[model samples]
Target: MLTHTPEMPHALQQLLDREAAITTLALPRRSFLKLAGATAGTGLVLGAFPPPAGAQAAAAGLKPTQQPSAFVQIATNGDVTVTINRLEFGQGVQTGLPMILAEELDADWSLVRSRNGSSDPAYLDPLFGLHMTGGSNSIKNSYTQYRELGARARAMLLSAAAQRWNVDVATLRTRAGEVIAADGRKLGYGALAEAAMALPVPEQVRLKDPKDFRLIGRPTTRLDARAKSSGRQDFGIDTRLPGQLTAVVAHPPVFGARLRSLDDSAARAIKGVKAVLRIPGDLGGEGVAVVADGYWPARQGREALKLDWDASSVEKVDSEKLLTQYRELANQPGARAFDADMAPLATAPRQIEAEFIFPYLAHAPMEPLNCTVRLGKDRAELWVGTQCPGLDAAAAAGVLGLKPEQVTMQVQMAGGGFGRRFVGSSDYVVEACHIAKAARAAGLDAPIRTLWSREDDIKGGYYRPMHLHRARIGFDERGNVLAWDHVLVGQSITTGTVFGQFMVKNGIDGTATEGLRDPYPVPMRLTVHHPKVNVPVLWWRSVGSTHTAYVMETLLDEIARATKQDPVAYRLRLIGDKHPRHRAALQLAVDKSGYGKKQLTAGRAWGVAVHESFSTVVAYVVEASVKDGQPVLNRVTAGVHCNLAINPRSIEAQVQGAALMGLSMCLPGAAITLKDGVVEQSNFGDFAVPRITDMPQIAVHIVPSAEPPTGMGEPGLPPLAPAFANAIARLTGKPLRELPFKLA
Candidate 1:
């Protein structure tokens, strides 16, 4: 229970002073120039007029939004509670964050509990400059903050015990909720709780030396494992409230098509149908809501409702037509996303060319789209599972014509968001607000839960835009790459939408052009972004990397085959020094799996792909074969570097799950097909997902690093598709240049 202050031990101070002196005179002459430009710009000047002594910029993170609280609160009864801001959403962040806090707090592990925090500014992300949980930032971003919180709390408790015992704080030590003095006298944390609160907050704290860390780097069971297994926990689908009525909407079969008219006479006659409202401009399109005493009655009433749709314009739009148009647009000039002026070397003696097409994909979350809104004249409250609650609140208020504060958003456990939850325009939550406000204008209780049928959720707007890619690589007679050219044509994810404006300021959606900038540093490289401008699109799981990684990694694999070099060895030479973690993972995966040594059955082969996303580096090797003339993945091995490695088990779970999700998206996951602008796949029967029998044996190896934890949820997704696609090419002796690989 030693309450060490900011003052360092004299021995440590002397050691640091000697090290600083040694570093100052050992640099090269030009080092000072670089330091002046970079280090001096950090607000310190050596020879110039120094600012007054006390003018040091108030310790970097002193913003009004930053909070000093981030650890466990031990109640008098020994119940340890924690307030976490990161959304759980089945990512296990709720469990991972608390593990860090508990280890530093020195709490009784068995008595600890965790919960989500209220929407407060104290939870802002230091990186996003705002409060957000997406981009795989939950654990990577909060680990240190949460740990510091515990360390600060531990210091406070030690100070309190020192005051009560009247003993020198250094003679006291803490372990598992008790403060013990050298004389063997002990005091529980609960006994000193009040005194601890009165102590001044420390300006600095030291973390536990890694060798002494007990819980971290160790496999601890998930905090919510019991509740989920026993079916006691409530997900969004199981939510309920008093006096709540069920409602359902039978929206149009296509986007931009309005409801010209509808007949609800049969629906109104249903047994439990309370009201059938033909609302105008609901969700800025055709809207019809059937309200009933229960969900079953509303569902039954929806089946009887008939409507005349204004699908004239959309009637001409189709998936096949869009695909053809995208290919045509790829040849024409659009916005240039990244350019390297490779036109001088365009006429090389030897060149390789290929085209890759990606189809439209859906974010069919398990819970579908649902929201419960209770609206009054100037006040509203919405209960839903959204990734961005602050943004959701603003959108809710705008739709209801109320001030932002008038709307209260309760973030529930999302079944899944991916990138689907951040959507602003044409959002389901916006539609729910419209429905609730409309119901109130009709003078009812004004509280209704809008439930989107599985079909509506699938056929609705905002899909992963279909993309077409054309690439040409110029090589010398020595087989060295001389130039690289890539042309991409696809619907800009941010065009003509609220988010599109911010993302396309320079007429380029950085997301759409990522992974194309060519960090490979070839002699000449050019990437052109041609905006297709078709249907409304949104970000899916890995955003642009989902498609871009496939193109880049698969093309590199082709080059490896052309050079007759090992794929791993070839990528190792091309990686340069951009990402050391990626290199480490590549080497580890290649070594552990014996990647190029063994062969599976004839006509079966393996492929390797590596990528860095959300701060984490991941590499995947897949073993697959053509089954019945279709690519079938039989096994997968992955190496991940989520630095600092919080809960190795949880990281493994995320990597395994993300790999499976990626596999399903590549092989059998659902896609949106349009015929005359009408989506054909309405539900799971048509939009297939991976079943248990479809999963391969996935093995995960975690490479530990001290680089601070990065994102683990999504980095594993980008490489799976390319790995599987490359494996298919090896097995069939032909590169499958499109998604949903079709073997011949």
Candidate 2:
């Protein structure tokens, strides 16, 4: 293993390490390259992470990753292990990406395995140039990258076998884990891996034509499926290290509220309680972390603490008052996202004015937030299922007063994280580091595991920003949109983060207005209002589209209703030929659902909605009914146009899960309410999610396309709620405005 010296600059050290990695990949075979406290074992290891398209021109000296050896490693037993760059939090990238590579490498599917990557620069996203995962772009961005990696590795293996057999490299072909000579001699990959690694990595290689792909489009089961199904899969929350101590923090009642006084007499008296120390929390808030041998005692200690909070510095956000303020702001123009004439709205033959309220939502991954930090004299190590390890490491360095390179953020498999783990502030990671630092200062020198209970995870801040969208639309009898005026009011999720500069412009956040009046080509003038609030807000699952799509789709359906037009036909007419993907998806959903053909149950009505987000289009044709004083989604038929399907099963899984999450929004108690500056919902009892009894039967259909795949993680969610609401409206003859279907 190669290591960096103290006097060397990190960049220069990386350069030297890069050279060594090249040597290790091409000639020395068994050598490993170490960086940022990450250690590699004997096998082929990759160099830098994949770069974005034209990223080389974006920055000087940046190039696409050239070392194919870095990603694929063939063990002696013929098992292939692929290193995945992004976090594997239930999105099948761990399987899909490897499938892309292994498809080109022609490896046996059963022997393929996957491992996680850390904050090492080699793990940065190929497109975004960051160590992060969100936007549902993981497969879309990395498709070509992994394909190329596998192709190059295959070339190297062929060359190695050719040399061994004394023949031309062009005469060799690769099959499942073996290279075949023209004379029918076969050499296993494990036998040739060392020699293959010794060969110089080819700068370029030809990718396989889609027609020849064995794994790329196949519906393969995830490599982690069985372990996950049997509950044997390990998550970061299950991490255990010797001498590890658990901590439970008592947060202030309000956002940014500081602890005025703390009495830890009873807490410290607990048997396993090691110490109780004050620590900083999200939004400049202060809290007490109770350290104990395990979670139970730490939680008990936290419950025993007598505390008083000072909330004078923070705004006391009340949901009722805030909604009123948002409604008032909706009438006033704050910033222009789209400006078009709205004079025709008043004189149009039909008109509709709608206001939609989307409550703050929690990500609520199965595993609550957890981070384990072990501090050394000059360095720190962390184990967590973080979305962006590099950002988390930097934040940890600041909290530990160590150099960024001194901190190693080891990535782990997460249970789930729609968008919660990818925080701009690295809130949970920083909080864990702060607890570690304070414990060290208090002379409790042990590895600290900070755990958030289900209650803590739900009440903890960084929720989806509550949004109110008001739209006034006018259309003719033919369903041609004459004029539309729209306003969106919400807190900006990126206003104060590193992304603010890129995502916010001229006082308007791009995220807030993303899903408004697009693909429909309506002459819509959109105004956005970003009110400052003390409550913390972050992206949750589908981000702005969560509310924006609901508003846009439902309103369009209403216009279709008023104009006596079929919903699917109207949406297709608006989309036209320009947006083939949208039209195709909507048409597919309609065709597959047997809309205007298939008969439904006596009370069930057809609901239709289509939306495009993250460069992918999803259309939902749902059969729904109002049962037991609630809107019941009986079945969902989804038409997904993601261009190319990497793993159709994964796409189906994502759609099913995301659609259910969308359905959760329409159920009672789905909203996360704020009352007098405190979160009203603490657990699943008050903060509702979908139960097994509530799950609707769903069938996902992919539009056949040879184009590159788009995002699949988020697009399926946006259309579900609106489609359900549209059906509920048909049943009651009154359009539903708010979520959770407040039936009278």
Candidate 3:
């Protein structure tokens, strides 16, 4: 705002490799130009616009998904390359989605390859109609769409084969990229692909039954494994162009601080320095961009510049003071989210009052945020790793004084986003476009690469909102909740953005209250407070689940402990039959972890936590011990129920990665604090993340089902910290409330 810097363990690294390193193709900026109905610079834009020409064709009856030319490319040698719609940023969708398509296409696994898609109309999410890759919706939302794409392509191939053989289409069958006639004659898909494109796309094509699937649910190795592991993978930061100049922005230390004065005399004297530009910053403030022949000189030039900032216009957000303010706000009435009877809270057999404090968190992806923009007379092209490609393109066009149709956003495989690259503001992209425009005006007229160093990424404003949760609960001795009143105070992540209309309702942001209640059928009255703060905030990985899941799971575990009932039994009884996915996941984790049947090592204790986020449910059973006064996680067993498994290995790897990310929240030095409106932490040394040495032995077990797939990218994270904390609480005999656990 955006790898152990959101870097990863070995298993997690595999998922990341598969996500970013698409096999066998060094796709060019216009590699997707041949995509059916996918003309460069012509896709959906931010607000309202006339249907793009490509979209108009779809409206005229050629559904883009049904067009084989858009998704499938059968090379003359029987190799099939599939274009993935979503940005592959370590969720493994770059491979997992292709497995779904290739399964139906009957393509030979060894010859299958993948590449990233453009911000084309056909590449939009089939359900949401947006160029987005968040919410773990890559597989969940596009499963059927991609399947139908493969089915249509296969059908077309069969038709072409049948026409050539002078036989009925039904008389031919497909097997391993070949069409087989009833008489045993075989024609490879590559042989018939050109003719297949001439045939009309079928309006309806049948998908394969789950029982007949070959590629899915199998622990197959990723096709791009070799490329990424060999350090040959190229992220957006690696973009290089002829006569390209690198730019570094000298930002204000305070959020939204305007540039008061600048002295660039020494900066201009640097050998490689070309021009210095004053441009709009991430916020509405001003920042200076130093342009040079390369990154080293750009960085040096920026370091040499003398600048003064005016921060009086923006509020100085002090974390400690904000905490006090939030506590006071929590004491007052707020906009209602859940309105339940709280009469019983006044008098009950047992009562528990708790206040949880969570500080701002950074999405510090290993590869820092960067964007490269090349501008011509009337058009602009961008190379970036972004979650909102279309929006970014539209924003770029706006900044470049061109129409949306004149800008091309060449989507690149990101190193890791974790919501850092999906900013509603298009902050970094906008900065790059402005830099490009300013450079061209200064007679540079060359592509400009705007790079954010680790320090810039760390101190950048957009962060997971600091939240304060106050809960007063009154329950009977049986641990049955009678009345619970809860209040949450945090900045709204989608307040003024395009997503605010839906994400924010009445006056409360739904993100802050997403996982709070209803899962347990608890009688809870919830109130939310969205305070105006100078610190910019955005979604971080699991978003609100970062804190909500912790509160719910830990409180539930405390209730179970207070009632002297088994935690699992209590949760099961509370969950009941209404939520089978949660029950299945929890039971699987309990069974696989040997929770009750096997005794743990002498100092180790067990912790169990289950939560549902992004429609997928994950349960974690963990073993932990206090070593030298620090809580050390020993082992973890997870049971995930995300419906059907696309790739078991990918799911396992994703869970392992997400579990580590979740564990990071509990590690000391994980929080991002502010003193007088400036971020205090800058790098991994100060802002800690989990490395392999800190990771626990994790085993991910997926619950078998064929109810289609749900999100896997984020569900694994919510349950982790809670489970670990529950184990620590058992050993300490006190419930833990805050993150980055303080034993004192």
Candidate 4:
């Protein structure tokens, strides 16, 4: 027995009092295109087709009030607005998606504008049937979808013009947002847009050949570059509402710790302090929130409060003890990821056993987490920079006791995410909803903005899990691996979350063993141990490949050195002819880097490594030197094969940015450690990130191809650290088995 309404479901309405006065804001629509009737007796709205079966099933329990459009809008002024289904977040999806649609639309690049889409059904990832922007799948998944959308829109526009002129549609062709007749008459898309909306959408539209592309594959500048550079961009942190109040919370030192007692007398005395309330935290804890007119007052009021916490029930994890436990676990057999014969290990002429350690890392985006919630009696609205708006919207509905359709998520621009904003737990959003509910209970009827400071953000839990890898490899003089036994000890990132159903199989997490064996035809026995730790962990950048690539590439380089062979030649022999992309990428980097022809400048040495991740291959050739007992990366050249380059400039920027982050992993004090269940580092003072002075000169070259595009975001990151470390190993003659490269 379920009560259903156009607005919401009955199960959610039970939590709300029907008699309560609804407080709805008269805010202007900020979600997407608005369909307003024009004077010309033409339908302004483009009707959408019925949802696909997958999308319908995903939205069965809770139907969305509005369906997502197919991402094309031709306004009366001839301005073509393209809506991106993913967050911009400094990645060029804002520009790249538009380039894709505009290419097929034959729209002039100068007249194209892009907007960030909200948590709508139309914006879900076509393959996953989920609203998300991760795994570098933005362009990879939406490339064809957007192109088809543009082609459809173009077809309708031409059809509209043909009907108006009483000519066959074949006689009308589009060029730069204009429908032209074979006899030289032309009509701008704007004049045909309203009329085009009445025609039925074509079942299929012909796409342009790769050779006819004017925008795709071009090295175009980002559309948001001017706004971001001139400080005109409004990130999530910059969100403001008419009656919004700033909020700051005092969380317990240990995660999931409850508040025992609180004294808020001093906090109430602070000027502009509105309300102080205790609210439930994300990880089954209770925290105090201070609400005020400004951030400083809220922060000041929070600092003035005195509270006692009870952390006895939670595990007090120590980084040192955790590593010790992992080391012990690595020594024993664990869940099998890959099984290979171990009998060949004893007969091998040479063997190498090495153990590698990687510490936890924080995503630490420039803009800390901030979510603004305005709750009414029947509906609510949220403004935030989210990677998964639909997921966050559902989580908000659950927290606010409202139906999913009653919530509106206005996606904002983000400084950076690096896999931080897309949490399965939806911890940050839930926390904000809790604070807002508490504020309403305490008689503060206004939007609440829960903000995180730099310290709070760094200390906040979801981190890249710490891992320990132990490998036993047996190889011959010719650099052929006989047998390799490897074990990885770490917590499974997807163990208890929704992703665990498909991502964790056969008692092993695929993320932990993604780059173990491939492209080299290695007979390896790989095992993994996933310990249940108290620390919250999530994906960081390239996920497991962040460390697995380092291990595989560096070890292969070691084998090449042991055999007295050129690293590139050894890699080619191991890769064989099956992986031409790898071979071409490696050879391109080598030739461009002048590896064999150029003489080293005194103490510098050349390093080479190549690896594939996310269906894209990236190879690096680096020059490094040791100065004052520290490794210094001087210059690097990258060869990339991501199929087709949507925007070469975007690819170049992504590679340079990812490479710098990879280099940051090699610097001292870059690791995040915990002692007694408390994060050791607070801000950049302790946690090291690369600065301008630390960046190396990097040149990116892409392999030309007409094939469909693959991911470029993460593939550039995997090979960078290993290539730099191999060069350092050459100078020191010692294998570096740990991150932040310790030399004694």
In model 3, what is the error at residue 664, expressed in angstroms?
0.6
- Candidates 3 and 4: which is better by lDDT? 3
For model 4, which pairs clash? none
In order of appearance, the predictions have TM-scores of: 0.87, 0.93, 0.93, 0.92
Model 4 segments beyond 4 Å from truth?
Answer: 1-70
TM-score of 1: 0.87
lDDT of 3 by residue, 464-535 (tens): 999999899999999999998999999999888766756788999878888898479999899999999999
TM-score of 4: 0.92
Cα RMSD of predicted structure 1? 12.4
Clashes of each: 4, 2, 5, 0
User: Compared with the true structure, what per-residue lDDT tens digits does model 4 show for residues 563-610?
Assistant: 899999999999999999999889888888899899989999888889
Tens-digit lDDT track of model 1 for 479-567 = 46777777887777766654454457467776687666354556534445545443567888777888888888888888888777788
Model 2 scores a C-alpha lDDT of: 0.83
Q: Candidate 2: minimum summed lDDT over ten consecutive residues — where?
A: 1-10
